[model samples]
Every structure is written in C-alpha cells, then in structure tokens.
Target: MNLATSPATQTAPATLTDFFLKWEKSQPEKIYLRQPVGDAFIDYTWAEVGQQARRMATYLQSLGLPHGSNIGLVSKNCAHWLIADLAIFFSGHVSVPFYATLNAGQIQQVMEHSGCQALFVGKLDDNPNRWAGMKPGVPAGVNLIGFPDYAAINDADLVPWDHIMATCDPLQAVYQPQPDDLYTIIYTSGTTGNPKGVMIDYRAVAEAVSHTSVIMKHNTPNARFFSYLPLCHVAERNVVQATSLATGGTVYFAESLETFAKNLAVAKPTHFLAVPRIWTKFQLGILAKMPQKKLDLFLKIPILSGIVKKKIREGLGLNEAVLILTGAAPMPKSLILWFRRLGIIIQEAYGMTENLGAVSMMPTNDIRDGSVGKVYPGMAVKIDPQTGEILTKSGWLMRGYYKEPTLTASVLQDGWLATGDVGTLDKDGYLTITGRVKEMYKTAKGEYIAPSQIEFGFADNMFVEQICVAGQHLPQPLALIVLSDMGRQAERIAVERSLEDTINALNPKLHNYERVRKVVIVRDPWTVDNNLMTPTMKIKRNVIEARYDAQLQPWYENDEVIIWE
Candidate 1:
C-alpha cells in the first residue's frame, strides 16, 4: 500500500520512515544516535543507521512472512531498538514493543495476544536471573533474532545481528505504506488487568509527531533528546523516537540504570521528559547534597541564587535542557513550584495511549498552578457534565484496541475517546484533573473519595516518597506511604513527627469521610519487579488494596496516628 494511491496523502505530513529516508540521503554523515558503551560512546551516523536497518529489513523479508506481520521488539532503549523498528517499517510489518521490564508471564501474554511472527531481543536487564526468567516467554514457533550482547544472553540457536548484516544485502525494494496502514501496537501499562493493545496508524503517528513538534517549539534539526524511559510506552515512543525522526534531531540512549547519571551528563539533552518519581528523586538527590533549609537560604540571596540554580542544573545534567516535561501520572503542584524556584519549569502533559498521548501539554510559559495547560490546536476536549470525565477527539486517536472490537467501541464512541479521567476545564480552557473515573472509590460513609486529589495533599512532604489513599468500605480513607530516601535516613522520631504533622495539617482541609484515618508506612517499597508498581512508576491500586485490605481494619482501630508496617 503506497501513499500515492490514497487521497489523504496529498495533505498529510511525512511519516517517520519518510523523514529517516530523507535524512539518510540529505545528511548521511550526520550523527543520528549516540549509544553509550562502558565509559565511552558509540555514535551511529545517519548512513550507518540506514545501512544496518536496510540490511535487517532484507533479512526480515527473506523470512517470507506475510506482509504486515506483527514483529515483537523486546529491548531497553538502545540504538538497535530504533534500527529494528525502522527495519520492521521497511519490511511492511507492524511493530509490537514490550516493556523491557516485563516478566516471563507478561512477555508470553503480549506475545501470544499480538501473534508476533518474529521477536527481536536486544539489551535487557543486566541481572542474568531476570533475563533467564524472560527467555522462556517467547513461544516455540516465533523466530528469534538477537542484537549484539549488551546485558541479555544471546543463545547459540538465535540468529545474531552481526550474521544478518554480513550475509544479507541491503533491501533494494522498500515498502511504502499508506497513511492509514498500521504502524505499531502499544500495550498499555495495565494497572488493573490485562494490558490492551492500542493500534496506531502511520497517519496518527505523523499527526502526533508533527503537532507535538510545534507545541514543543522543536522544529529544528539541532534538537537533542535523551531516551531513558521505556520506549514501549506511547509517551516515550512519540516524544523521543517519532519526534526525533520528524524533526531530524539526535537521540542518546542511556547504557544502564547504574550509569544513567553519567550517560545523561554526557548527553545534556535539549529536551528531557521524566516521570514524577524521577523528578522527585532528582529533588531528593539535590537536597542530600545541600539541605533544603541551606539551599533556601542561598536562594534568598539574589547573587547566590543564580549560582546555586546553575550548579544544580549542571549537576543534574539538565543545564542545556530547553524543555523539561513530566507526565504518565499526576505530578504534585508543590513539586512543580519547587523546581520553579531553581529556574526549572516542569510542563505537566496529559494524555493516554488511546489518543497517541498528544491530547494536551502545559506550555513552557503561562503554566497554571493546578491545571495541565490547554488542549492542542487540532484536538477537541469536553468534560462529561455529569461525570466530569475528560473526553477528547483528535485526528491522531488510535484506530482501536487491537482485536478487541467491543472494548474499542466502548472507549471510542462517535470519534470521541473517553479518557476515563475526571477533570474540570477553567474559563480559559486550562484542565484540572480531579481523579480517574474508575480509580475513585466510595467510603462506608457513602461519599466517594478521589485518592489522587487526596494524594496530592501529601506531595509537599519530603518524608513521603510513594503514597496511595485507599479505603473502600471504610469509614474514612487511609494513606499508605513509602518513605523517601531522606525519610528513611532521618531519625524515626523526626520522621513520625513530620508525617503526623502533615496529616494533621491536611485532615482539617478535607471532608470527614475523605480524611485519612491512619498513616501506614509500608516497610517494603513497591517496584516494577514486585508487580506493585507499573513500569512507569504508577502504583497499582488494586494490587495494593489486595495486599493490605485484610489489615486495614486493625490499623484503623489502632490509636497511633502513624503505624509502621
């Protein structure tokens, strides 16, 4: 299916692959990707990337799979991941990306659901046990191709990337897909149940990337992006991969979790996007070096403030960042204001996989205290008057949930994607998200409580790292918290006093039903490995509730304001 046959192509923007081919010819020698090796960097120029991708495309074509076959890409962020994606596009296949952190069961579930014909395994967890657990997830019939060994073990039976490059010639006939052709299937980070596969077409990708470029003011080729987040996620895929391809920007990949700070320092990315947890970690790291009281005192001095902010930015490897964004979850307003004091403006974006994650973004300037900025130019947003649910319509919305017509119809009705999030729009069109439609739970008092709104109240407390306000069928909501690094290191008496103070100050503001009955400091942290949190750092409310529901009554009955788990 070629673009020439479609009328939509006449006015539609160039697709991601189109931009790649353009760059391959126009500036073949320009550095396109910088991948870190231990203590050094391996740069891949446009020509180098093109050559490898074309060779891989030829190999994939030789497999004789049906056109538009679903190909699985399992990898952490690396140069080869992008190359493999391009190869999939050139070979006329739909790419299905799995989160690198997925366990064996999750890998098998997505692999089986997507019906992937081939799986490209690349950089994964450095821990051998993790990779061992994931290896069996690939079904027997699926062809396996392994990238150069970085962290994952490349079994002897799998075809090596080097072998394909040496044996296969560059594919002479490249597949040119139409605007409506399926591009990729992104699985949601399912917090509740099985993740749904969102099918996005080439036109949606083009529209999302192009519109986001304009919104971010990153149209120039000099833009630099750091790719550390899970590329499988829609936000990272659009903001980092597709945006870079469309804008002719350079992309840098982090080597590993241990070396993330070092790798980021080298990249000094012009545009950086991180989850709220990451921003909190950065804040905590800074505070560890210079206590908040001391830093506040320095910032009060006009001359010292500038120096302090500059040093902090450079230390965090964001000195060159023109745009820093946070999303995938609600960020605390207090955290945004705290960064502002350091001259760092965090633009909180709002979107989901169903909308190609391009519904709205906070403008660099004109940031509202509690709102997630205005809607995009080509997007239509309306709140369900009764439910306060945010519904959006856009040209770039996903085609549907892959192979789930019933589910697709439920969310995508009459061209409007029900965001499943409740929010209010101000007179000026700024959006303030109240809570998720499904996440809100009713207390025994019959009043519904929005955990997210109540959770935000504790964001200003540095002692709290992760929090979930969950108490369904209880008289009042209870706060389950994980202590921050600072909190863990502080004297227990000090930590308890601080948390008690936070609850006391916050409870007066909330309704009687919404007030937190007790503050439970969970001993174990929720992590992706433990399945308590999603890959993006969002706590799984259902999972958390199931784990602690039996003990909630006892904790509530206890007289202590702060209970240690």
Candidate 2:
C-alpha cells in the first residue's frame, strides 16, 4: 500500500525568498545568524542579513551576467554561505554548491558540468592542500568573489566581500522568482563514478519546506539551529537553511572542528540534526571520559540518573534540544538504544538528493528502532516487489538530473522516483531499508548477498569502527574492519575474542553463502582526504572493495577467524 498524497501541490507555492522577506519585515532586529569569530559570535540581524544579500546581489548583476545563470558556491558551513545562496536567488540565478572537501579534479568536473558563470569562495580549512588546490580548478573566465578572507584563502586578486558592500548600493528591486524557476542544483556525493547534479525548482523547495516544517514540528517562530554539516548537502540545506527561513529561526555556525563542541554549547540548538557517524563519535567521546559500566550504574539510581543525564546533556550541548535527528545513512538499532538510555531519543530520517531530502522521518511520539518512520504527510511510498527497491513520489521531487536527460528518464518513471534503496514497509507504515539495489554482490556459488545487511549486524560491536562486507566471486563474503580508538587501545587478544563472539552470534542468523568467512582489520581508517569515504562520511563501498581485492581471496582461505592487514 502507498502512503497518503500531499495537498501542497494544489496550493499557491511560497518561495524561500518570500519567507526571508517576511521575517526581515516583521522582525528586522531579530538575530537570524550567529557566526563565530575567535571566541565571540558576530550576530547578524534579519535586516543586516537582508542588506548584505541585496548588496551582493547588486554586485552580481553589475557583472553583466544573464538572468537565471548558474553561480557556484564552495565553502564549509558559515553564515556567509547562506548569504551567498540568498544573493544568488536575489540576483535571479541558480546556486550550485560544491563540497568544500573536493579536490581540484572533482571541483573542475562539477564547475564545468554545471556551467557556473561565477564562483563565490567562503570560509574553508587552513590547509593549503584544500584551499590552494581549489584555486586551480576554477576555469580561467569564471568571475571569483571571495567572502572575507579566512584561513589560508588569499583574496588579493579576487573581489572582496567587504569592498563590494562598501562600494555598491543594495539592489533597489530584488528579482522575483516564479514557481517554476530553477532555484539550485545540488550534486549528489556519488559513491562511484562522477556526481550527478540534481536540479530543483522554487516550487519543489516550497513543497519541501512546507511539509518538512509540519513533520519536523518547526511551525513555531524563533527556533534555534546549529549549522556544521555541509550546506551543499540536501539534508543540511533543508534542515538548517530552509527551515530557518520557514520558521524565522536563528542559525549558529561552528567556528572549526576544534571549536565545534564549544560553539555547540553556546548555541544550545532547539532542533539538532547529525549523521550517524557523528552520533557514533559522540558515544565514543562519552565512553572515553566515563566508562560505560559507571555510566550504566549511575543511571540505575533515580537521583543520580537525573544528575548524570542532565550533566551529559549539558556537556554534549544538547540541553535544549527538543528534536534530535540522524540520517544520510542507516543508523544501527543498538546505537539508537544506547542514546535512549540517556533520555535522548534520536529520530532516524530517510531521504536522497533527488527528493530535496524530504521523505520519511521517525516521529517523536512513535519511533520504531531500525525503521525510518512513516512517510511524510504529503508523500507516498511503496516497495517495488520485483527489485525490492523503495519508490516514493512527492511534489518536492527534483526537476531531473541537470543536463543528463537519459539518466533522468531512467530514474523518474511517470511521477514516481525509483529510489535505488531497497526497503520494506511494515503494516504500521514504517520503512526499514534493507540495502541498496546497486550494492548487491554475487558469490562464487552464484548466490547474491547484500553487504549492508551483514555490516549492520556488527554495529553493536564497539571494537569495529567501520566494516565493509565484500567477496565477489569468492566462496563466502569477507568482512573488512577498521579498528576504532577503543579497539586499538585494548589488548589484541581481547579485541580478537570480542570479534569472534560477534561473528559467532551473527553467522547463525545469515544464509550459509552470506556468512562472513573472516574478518580483516586494516590499519588505515577510511577518510574523505583519502577518497575512501564521501564528504558526508558514508563509506565508499566500491572503492574499498577494489582497494583490497587481491587480499580478499587470501583472507578467505586463512584458517584464523581474525586476520590483521
């Protein structure tokens, strides 16, 4: 059975700029963004943000670019990132955002593919390899505008943000976008091959924010948000940027990775969203300071439970968090339960770039572990019986993949999006993702196995930081694991024993062919810098499999249950 259809398609759509204008007029002095600078925060009121955006818009128009041109934005999360996006909209241009962690080759591919006439460079890491490497990627003719010089970025040759505001007057009339006008192009962080640009229009954004505001319970004004994730990502764009505009909420930016904790404490966000990896790191950090045995014991006492839970909440800067969300990748059920013990309910959400990141979200009142909640109020979802692939449809679905009509036609069939994810919808309407349709592999016995299903079984084992099951053409699948900090510090014998116990507990539940033959613990961790993982922190399964292909056969033939690489 399919979920309910959204009523938003019949209503007059309101663009993001409409919401921004509403707040700017209603509460001009209200702080809309808090940007961290050193130890202090520089607050930008609704009026101030509007003025800066208008000024930038005017400067953009002065460059003689055609209306509705595509402009590129690359930066880590910052207040100016939103401002740049707003400026792109104000100038009647489509904003194309690139992941800040992307290297020169990747950046060039996207910039050229998107046909960006100009590029805005904002706050990035101090590493020369990052900022310096990006410089060579910009095409020779594309105009460059630098947001106030931060980190290692040199703006001497580019137009300075401060100079533009000083010299140019705010645009007298902002460009008004129609419902069908293209708004932004969000490129997917492809696990394999080149990224595809997802084209979204103003109408789609309106539908997304309208439904998301109600589903996420962000209807009230003055909500607080912390922005750290890449705004380029569809999830972060909707949750932090679009939601703020929809609710007139305040958004705070993290200064850097080193100061993320300190900045989070300052913001005390009312609604928080993080990926599963971040949640895991938080759990590991807590266990590092206070042993799990002690934490579990403290919670058994009524009085100490309150004190301990409150202290932990305050320490994690989630003291005021009313809604906590995790998504982008599947979260382990064990990890969710672990947080529940501390009185923190983490709601898992499911979405993709094609849908503007609005799909299924776990409800606060009725959360089912291992399920990504029910479909959004206006969306419909169903499982394709043949492929076991999840299909969803909503008004917020993307226009199509930019400049890739054949690819677009392949995924968008009639009105339904053929989400490549495999999932099951329960009687209660909750969706449990099983695996990706493209991620399935065949063993030498010609039986197919979904690696995600196997890897998820190992999530409860803290010793395993990251695991990928791979064994194409092999007799049985092999598990490749990267040891976590806790695992590395523990005695080798203990680590081996823990892994063996996990294997014993999990193997019985799997099919004979799907069972893992051995566990290979690799020394190097998968990271974005190494290209073994995406910027969003999802492991690159194909890359990992190819990297250790030769070892797979050798490891499968080994006698020991655990093999060190």
Candidate 3:
C-alpha cells in the first residue's frame, strides 16, 4: 500500500474498469444473470446490473466505512449477492464470502476473523437461522441489510441494506482499483481447528478467469454457465463468475440443491462446474432408478448399450453443456467413465486457493482419465522429485496469506508455490494427482496407503455415497463408507439383505491392501456445514478421522463385515 505516485502512472486511473465499462457500453440490455425462482427466472441485463452496482457502491460509501474494509456476505447462489460483490469493488472495499452452511458460531468466527466491517444478507438459505440469529443490535461500523426483512436501509428505522440501495444514487465513486489489491478472505471449511482465512488479490482472480475461459472455449457471448458451487470459494467466484464476466457469458444460479438438476435443464447451460461428491450422487440416482441387473445386461450388448446411454444423456440435461467440468475434489475415474459412457465428458481441473483457481486443467478436446489435463496458459508446473509434490508458478498465484508471513513464506518460495499435493506428470505432460502429502497414512505393518486412490476406486459403486480410508496403525487400511440414500433405505428391509450381498460381491475384486476390512455406514451426509467437507466439497480427512474414531472400535471388536446398524 505504498500510496506513492509514479511518473508514467501519474493518473490514479480506475483499475480493470476497462472490462466491465466496455461491457456496459456494448450490450447494456443483454441478460447477464438468469436466476431461477420456482419455475421461472429473473434476468438481469448488463446495464441493469451496472445501475444497481452503482447504487450499492454509493450506499456502501454513505455508511462512512473505511476504504479497503472487508464486507461479509452470507447467502446462496443468487444475482443479488453478485450485485453486492461488484458494488464493494466499485467502492474500493474487499468482500469476505461466508459459506451459508456454517453455524452461528462459525459465522461469527469467520466474520470477526476476516475483520468484516459490515454484513450483507441476501435471500435466506437453508442455514438462514444461523446467519440471522447472530448478536441482535448492529454495532458502530457493522450493519445488517437484508431486503424484505426490515425498513429502509439508509433511514433512521435502520432498514435492511437492500432497501437503502433502492433509494441511493446510481452514480457513486468508481474504485480505481489495482491488480495487487486484496479481494477476498475465505476461510477453509475443515472440520477441526479455527478456520484459516486465505487472502488473494484481484489480479490472481482475473487471471484464473482468463485462463479458465480459454480452456473451456468460452470466449464469446453464446457461452451459458450454471452457477452451482458456493461463491465463497475462489473456484466458483473465479471460474464461474470471473469467467462469465470475461467471456460475456450469461450465468444462471440455481434456486437450491433440490432444484439443481431441474434448473440446469431450464437454463441449458453450455458450461457447468460441480464437485466430485455431487457427480457421485448423480451416478447413484441414475443407477437406483434403473434395473441394475437388466442395465448391466444391456450394457454388455454392443448396440443396445449405445442406445441406452444416449437416452440417459438426454435425461441428465448434460446434452447441453458444451463444457462439463469437475473439480474442488478428486473425482473417481469410475465416475468420469460412467459419464463418458453416456456421452457426457466430465473434464477434471486441478488447483488450490493458493494458486487462485486451476493451475492445470484437462483441456476439453484432449481429456484423459487419471490426468488433470495440461498446465494452464500461464501456469508453470514442476514436480518435486524427492517428495512427489506438485509445485506451481504463475502470475495468478496468491499475493500471500493474510497477515501470516511465515505461512505465506512456507508455501511461496523462490517464486513457486509448493502445492503439497503429491502428483506426477505423465510423458505427455498431463498431470496425475496421486494424493495429498499430509493425507497419506501408514498401516500397522508400515505399509503406505493413499486413501484418495482407494476412494476413487469405489466412486461409481451404486451403494456407496462416501468412502474414507482409515485403520492407521492397524493391520491394514479400512474404508468407512457412507451409503447412498438407496442403500440406506434398503438397509432396514429385505433390500438390506440384497445390498449386503451386492457390497460383499464388489469387495473381493479390490487389491488385498485396498479391500475394505470394515465398511462403516454413516447416517449423516458429509457437508460443509458439518465440517466433514471443504467449502468446495472436498472430504476433509482430518475431520473424518476425528468424527468416526470411536465408532471404528466396534468393527474391530465384533469382526463384522459392515459395522453400522
């Protein structure tokens, strides 16, 4: 923050204002966001959105908050949230995105930790109570502004924030922001320990969008995008939001998790991004509705298999997505191939918050299994020979972790960020991620196990919802599985007997060390709110081990094939 004036850069001109300003001037009425309601959607044009953003920026400045202060936003995928984000930028402020899944305590922790000066509540989500039930009165610099819940935002009645936006001026201060300015502070959604805030800059975000849009072939206005992942993570913000803006693509935000598929069909998105867990769930839903035995028989038929798959593709709404991308977690190869069989190619991308979004992604045209495609346009990737760690260097790499110099130094060294993910580059330069160096565990007999590897093997299994490799310091690695809804429903009746038979049948084919000695079926689903998964939907090994540590004993004690009741 050296406010020093330079000779050539004497004018304190607007930062990256060129992108949006040009867009507003070009297609002012072109729809940018198509957010779905129950059966319909409300579309926001570029000019319309820009007008709202201007009002929001003026309203934000009217509060007399400090420049560059963090503003917390809690909501689901909605157009209003995105509107507020741009407004914050226009006013020269930072946005701290909070996962709507967190509990009250967690929300407070993240807000305070990120030093958020104000909070903007968009439409109520599943976890609305936690966000709304925070300490009652607004403080000196902190305020609550949720529309339809309170009076005018700028009035003495202390109206909600959105209400105030309606009356504010549509011409406020334009943020002449720079590339190096801090943009967001997102806390990791791991189960244990206080969440760690990862800080990144605007240039890193824009760079991620630029490269991703190119890789996805989304360079024009015709590219339609589906916004499903949490905007709190850089993955969604950079990939979906920034990419859409960079390419002039229209983004459609789903109403909720339950309406996701239906909304996808309605939007007919050309680009879609999803976490691996959701993809696995989609596989289960399709398999459960079909007669598995009969389907297997048809799959064996040379001609019938293609016919069956063609029908499945149309039903899944995947026939529209020109680029169906998967990341935020390691996707099982089985799941990808299952989609491929249906003529839906799910390409995988690899990266972390430290690298902005994706450092390397499987190109849409040259996709291959067990590989996260080629290094992105500007990213330089190198594998550590000694430890097999993946290292990346790029202009998009994060400026540094917020206020944690030592932590930042550890990851960023010699102009390269140590990814900590153990991976290798194939002869063709496609990256194959093996496992996390920290997540790899040793068995009682000193055998090493990569749990992600084992979990991917069972990803397409019809009965398994989630599988975590465990049994460290034991004779062998064991898998703790969370069964699918179909498998769980079947567990209490005659179906339980059939499912047990099916699960037992699949176990024998696994390698001796990889075979699940005890399958512990969990009642609860893994979620970001429960701390079992990351905000980006990655399974947190540490969280899984801690939550199920006690229950694992019964499996060892009873000598049971499946431990859960």
Local error of candidate 2 at 14, Å? Answer: 2.0
Q: Identify the superior model by lDDT, candidate 1 or candidate 3.
A: 1
Best of the two (2, 3) by TM-score: 2
Runs off by more than 4 Å, candidate 2: 1-9
The sequence of per-residue lDDT tens digits that candidate 3 reaches over residues 510-555 is: 6676566666666788876567876676677887888777766666
Native-vs-model 3 lDDT?
0.73
Cα lDDT computed for each candidate against the true fold: 0.88, 0.89, 0.73
Q: Can you write out model 1's per-residue Cα lDDT over 280-356, one digit (the tens) per residue?
A: 99999898899989999999999999999999989878988888899999999999999999998889898999998
**Best-matching candidate per lDDT:** 2
Off by over 4 Å in 1: 1-10, 151-153
Task: Name every residue pair that clashes in candidate 3.
Answer: 145-161, 151-159, 152-159, 362-373
User: Tens digits of per-residue lDDT for model 2 on 126-172?
Assistant: 46567788878888899888888565347565788988999989986
User: What ranges in model 3 sit over 4 Å off?
Assistant: 1-17, 134-141, 147-158, 293-311, 491-515
Q: In candidate 2, where is summed lDDT lowest over 10 consecutive residues?
A: 1-10
User: Any idea how many clashes model 1 has?
Assistant: 0
Best TM-score among the predictions, by candidate number:
2
Using lDDT as the measure, what is the rank order of every candidate, best first?
Answer: 2, 1, 3
